[model samples]
Structures are given as structure tokens and as C-alpha cells.
Target: MPSSKDAVIASLIKSFEAAPRREQPYPHWYLEHCLPTADVAELTALPFPAPALGGISGKREIHNATRQYFDAANMEKYPACKTLNEALQD
Candidate 1:
């Protein structure tokens, strides 16, 4: 059976190839519907920790304790994160 990551990678490749590409100073593609709506929703609904600023302003390094990331651990935990990471990689 194909894994969800494989399925999402196939969809993302197909969408990117089918979308229009514009090459000017740089080569780029405007990919649309890159991921399924359900997957996108799942990512949005993820309960990532949000640190309170408390009027604090600086780089994210300040709140490293409560910081959230899509690192290997999160990618392994979340299907949508893994799929999205795959889509962005070569």
C-alpha cells in the first residue's frame, strides 16, 4: 500500500507540472492546489504551542522553550507535516 506521503507527493508533482510556469529574471511556478484540502485543514488544526509575547519582541530564539517546529519529530508525528516537507524537497 502506498503511504500517505507517497500519495501527497504524487499529487504535488502533478499539480506543479500542470501549473503555469513563468521565467523572467528567475524561473518559478505558481502551483495551486498543491495539497489536498483535508491535509491543509489538518495542518491548520494542529495544536502547535503558541508562546505569549508579554510585550516581548525579538527573534524566535527568545522563546525557544515553547517554540514549535516541523523537525523530524513533528514530521514523524504529523502526516500533513511529512507530506508538506516532501513536497518542498527535491
Candidate 2:
């Protein structure tokens, strides 16, 4: 049997290849199982607090300081982030 990481990558590759390319109402594919259940849970469990937007709606870049992006530092710190990043790159 493949390892968990291998399995997730394989699943993502298969799902992405199978996803249809639609052009009608905006082109997009309905992908499923992009991430494992455990990985999803881990991501949702991250302790990053919500930004105090002060009732103002704007681009996500507005809270750049508060929001944690999946950069090299974050991937090194979060296993799920690393896994998801690798899977996408595959």
C-alpha cells in the first residue's frame, strides 16, 4: 500500500485529471476529495485568530499582516500546509 502522502497526491492527480473543463457560466471544474479528511480537520483546527476587519469589506490583501499565507515558513510549520502545497504542485 502507498504511504498517506503518496495516497493523497495520487488521489489529487486522479481527481484533477478527471475534472471536466466547462466554459459556459465561467470555466471551472467541480473537484472532489482534493484534500484528505484528516488534513481538512487539521487545517480547520489551526489557531489563527480572525482579523478585526472593523466592519469593512475589502480585498484579502487588506489583512495581509493578520492572515497567515502558505509560504515556506508556514509550510515548514504546518504539516497540512506542506502536504496540500506538494499535492497541488504535483
Candidate 3:
């Protein structure tokens, strides 16, 4: 059986190849359930960094919102997140 990672890569390739190439009224495509159920759950469970909407208003809220992105050291600490990142890169 193909590993989950392999399955995801295959799915991505298939999705891209099968995507409509012709110009339409509006260009758009969506892949439903692209990731496996477990991956979806894992990704969903991750604590996403809150958007710094207030930053747009010059409230200095961007500091807190963007902190998570600059914390690269923590990325390797979470195995699930690391794996997900690798999968995305593939």
C-alpha cells in the first residue's frame, strides 16, 4: 500500500493534471478532501497563529500575530507540523 505521503503526492499530481486548462469566466478549482483524514485532523488541531488584523490599523497588534512565523526553532519541535511542511514542499 502507498504511504500517506505518497498518496498525497499522487493526489496532487492527479489534481493538477486533471485541472481545467482552458480560460473560464472565472479561473477557479478546488480539491475537496485533498489531504487524508488523519492529516486533515492533525492540521486542523494545530493552533494557528491569530491574524494581526489590528496591525493594519497601526495598533502594533502585528507583533503578536507575526511572532509565530518568526519562531522557526519551534517548527522542528512539532513532528506533525514538520511532516506537514515536508509534505507541502513535495
Judging by lDDT against the true structure, name the best candidate: 1
Worst 10 residues of 3 by lDDT: 65-74
Taken over the whole model, the C-alpha lDDT of each candidate is 0.77, 0.75, 0.59
RMSD of each: 3.9, 3.2, 4.8
TM-score of candidate 2 versus the correct structure, residues matched by position:
0.71
Runs with alpha carbons beyond 4 Å of true place in candidate 3: 1-4, 17-22, 25-27, 55-74
lDDT of 2 at 52: 86
Name model 2 segments beyond 4 Å from true: 1-4, 17-21
C-alpha displacement of 75 in model 1, angstroms? 3.4
Task: State the lDDT of candidate 3 residue by residue for 1-90, as single tens digits.
Answer: 123666666666777777666557677765555666666676666677566464365556546545554134645655456555566778
Q: For residues 6-84, write the lDDT of model 1, one tens digit per residue.
A: 6678778889889999998699898988777778788878889577788887786787888878889998888777777
The regions of model 1 sitting more than 4 angstroms off are: 1-3, 49-67, 83-90
**Weakest lDDT window of 10 consecutive positions for candidate 2:** 1-10
Error in Å for residue 64 of model 1? 6.8
lDDT of 1 at 76: 84
Q: Estimate each model's TM-score.
A: 0.62, 0.71, 0.54
Clashes of each: 0, 0, 0
Q: Specify the highest-TM-score model's number.
A: 2
Cα miss at 36, model 1 (Å)?
Answer: 1.7
Candidate 3 — which pairs collide? none
Ranking by lDDT: 1, 2, 3
